[model samples]
Target: MDYQNSLAFAQEQDRQDPLHHFRERFYFPQVNKQDAIYFCGNSLGLQPKSAQMYIDNEMYKWANLAVEGHFKGEEPWVTYHELLAGGAARVVGAKESEVVIMNQLTVNLHLMLVSFYRPQGKRFKIMVEGGAFPSDQYALETQTKFHGYNPDEAIIEIFPREGEHTLRTEDILQSIQEHGEELALVMMGGINYYTGQVFDMEAITKAGHEVGALVGFDLAHAAGNVLLRLHDWDVDFAVWCTYKYLNSGPGGTSGVFVHERFGKDPSVLRFAGWWGHNAKERFLMEKGFKPMEGAPGWQVSNGQILPMAVHRASLELFDQAGMENLRQKSERLTGYLEYLIDAVPVGKDVIEMITPRDPQARGCQLSLLVKRNARQLFDKLMESGIIVDYREPNVIRVAPTPLYNSYEEVYRFSEILHECLEGC
Candidate 1:
């Protein structure tokens, strides 16, 4: 995995890559009809070439058949979301019945909280990691407030110990112990969005369940980037958006997972709609709402075939390449990026990688903590056509996605980043 600055080495890796054929399936961004170095999948994924056809087929079916397209056309629009279930289940490691494709990320998180975050007397606190996504923070604060509880008293935030840039596993477990008695839910991102640190979900779920609390994860960053076994890990619930590594285009439809243990539990509360009613009797015009058994019970609206079709195209690619194979390539690709970044003489002085050294502790993203002239450095990289994302304070996130990013892209990015630093 030694990344030398040469076209032959990159072409050699490309020739040997089993997943290399996948690059042709996507519509890469262009500068004079040549594909740009696309390393920002952590923000928005490249569009699949077939994505337009997927939507067009649906549009044609609708135009030709009108309302009858729901049940008449090929891959009927009626149950279109169901087409994504098996691939979704496989990606997240859950039972087919345990997964459902529906609303966006924050909406699904709120719905999951309604069912899983039922707090009792004294056991009302929800645990989350510090520096969580602003949307998650707002949702948790509102959820606590909706339940007649104050966020300051009912929400527990975990931060890293002194001199540490990330939260340690023992620190997280110890914090769980301190609030175990009063904890009602332990919900956090599967991977930290800013720091790119993957949390220990299996251990955290075990600890949370031991304390009589429900556990869940916001897998927005980890879903397609890392291997997840939500059911095997005994996670109570989880949610994710597909626009990142899943490559489902911008603001694509999101998904959810509920472990089979909650399959037949009628005690769980949910905000239900007509879309979640039993399909067999759905058109009977029944007055009472009878929700589906598993994660589908949480859907609050009808499926929009447009965005969901984009997700279907992306999932097909994931199914073809397999997540295990993706992770195998991802570690080496991101590892090479890290190695080259660290190899620069002044790389460590002007920029610091906040991501963990262990590959298992992160995905493809490496967040750089810049000391001075942060925005200027980021702008220079961008002007040179290295497309990475900049967080508010002082971090620039560079994600070399496995499906489409090449080792050459990583090497090129590192060289440009080094030049940017030298100029600064």
Candidate 2:
């Protein structure tokens, strides 16, 4: 597709977009008394229009049914999280039984690590990406310490070579091979947050397994943004927050994926709770902890109705739009953003794009390394009602989400950015 930098071209593209109607489903933030051009879905997605209705329905249930809402209300709070398993499975490419909606991301990561990150004798090292999300870094550090190993010795962080901004596939594969013998687990983010680079999870999984190591991923950035096949890729476990691309509310409930092999295994070590016990036998309150059959068995508590309600509302939209359709639009939308940015006279010299040029290596996000007046530029865009985010130092991250963001919005942003740069 030849992308033109004109507003007419952007409008034409929006006219042809099959998923254009999805933009109406969300409520955008106000900017200058009009809908802002929201390019921050990589941070937090806009609220769905139906989210309030969904929450209200649950509130009604709680008001009317009280404790009986667990069994009697519409959808039943006792097994409310179950409502999400099929949709969550489709997003992550897992079996229904292999997926569960549960605690927030880092908590789920810790729970998965409890079962999968077993280090025995000499094979005690954990391999991870160098600049992992701080939560993951802390989780790995503490987990290593809990097992009586020094974090400095037990954790191996693979960094990008020299001046490169992202990890090369070959470099990652080679590192896995080099540490094969001592590696107890291979854990990484499915996509790097700062760079917006999608990792090759299938390749990573194969490499980890070939070396007799378990593999898992924190899919916070990747889950709704990219195509994933956690089950087919033989990923041992994975966790993701729904607020970003999934468009759930802030601090939304997260989803987890466990391969069928472990999902069916009752003997796996987990910090169990009553909600995870077999549903049929749960009422008896018997002593033995006979776990539920699959990923639901990992649940440490009962569902939080309000958050799950908001999540279900968004998942319904995803089901209607389909991930494949969303991905197609995403590629074109992000590509258009790139094209428009490049057409600016000062774009090449004033700002550097750190994300990979290849679409397969990234999602909707474009991380710009702004060389001059970065904060001022970001503030100018903000004041103009263009909603993008600025990271520390000098990076501005813009995400043109396929579901709600428009091509015209991308074009408008480029024009605004160009004007700001010229004045600076």
Candidate 3:
């Protein structure tokens, strides 16, 4: 599809867009007293207009029902987390029973690592992509240290070839096979946070299993942004936060997907709590820990109502938009962003896209590697009311999300960027 660099063309696209209305469902942050063109959904999503109403409902329930809210309200606090399972499962392409909306992303990662990362005998090494998000790197390091293994020796960091910005899928699969013998677990981000590169999780998971290694992914950037089939991919375990593309509030609730195989196994080792026990016998105050049927069995505590209320508000929007529809619009929206960026002729040395060109290999984000005055350019964007984000060293990330961003906004952003580039 040929893209034109004109406001009229962008307006036409917006006019025809099916998901365009979703943009109005959110309140954009003001810049210079006007709505800023927000391209920062990859870092934090815009709050849903209905979020306050959802919060109010819960607040009212607590005010009126008090302790009885646990069992008496329309959505009982006791089973509140369960209300999110269907939406969370749909977003990540997992069974309802296999998905649990709980804990933060890093916390869930640690919990999943405890259950999946079992290094024994001669096989003790963990393989991960080099320069992973700091949280993942730290989690793997501490887990290895906890198991009495030297991190440098116990973790293998695979990097791209000398000049490339993204990992080749073939290279990753080959590396997995080469180190198959010593590999105890394969941990990677579904989408690299820095480069916005989406890894081939299905192939990676298959390769890991072939080597007798358990596989998992950190999908903080993938969930609600890309097409995922964790259950179909046979991913052992995965975790993600909802604050980014999911449009939940900041520091929002997270979700975990445990394959049915593990969820059904009562003997599986987990740091369980009272809520993870059987619901029928929860009030018995029993001495033994009898696990629930599926992913809920891994819960460490009862549901969180306030955060989940806000989450539920956003989930309702996802239910209306549909992931498949969102993906279709996302490809076009992000592809247009790339086309406009390339047309800028910013000079390859000055600025270029580090994100994969293939729409299938990326989500809504395009990471621009600015060789000169990266921070200056980012600040200019903010000052101009174009809300994007900057990463360390020299990368500026912009994500024109399908739910809230319009084509006209994307066009305008390029024009502002062109103006901003002159001074930088």
Which one is best on lDDT?
3
Report how far off residue 407 is in candidate 2 (Å).
0.8
Ranking by lDDT: 3, 2, 1
Those runs of model 1 whose alpha carbons end farther than 4 Å from true positions after fitting are 1-8
lDDT of 1 by residue, 282-317 (tens): 789789888888887777787888999888989998
Whole-model alpha-carbon lDDT for candidate 1: 0.90
Residue 391, model 2, lDDT: 89
Per-prediction count of colliding residue pairs?
A: 0, 0, 0
Each model's lDDT comes to 0.90, 0.92, 0.94
User: For model 2, how does the per-residue alpha-carbon lDDT over 373-423 read when each residue is reduced to its tens digit?
Assistant: 899989988998989899888999999999888899999999998888887
Query: Which digits, one per residue and each the tens of the lDDT, describe model 3 over residues 335-365?
Result: 9988898878654558978999999999999
lDDT of 1 at 31: 51
Report the error of model 2 at residue 111, Å: 0.5
Lowest lDDT 10-residue stretch of candidate 2: 339-348
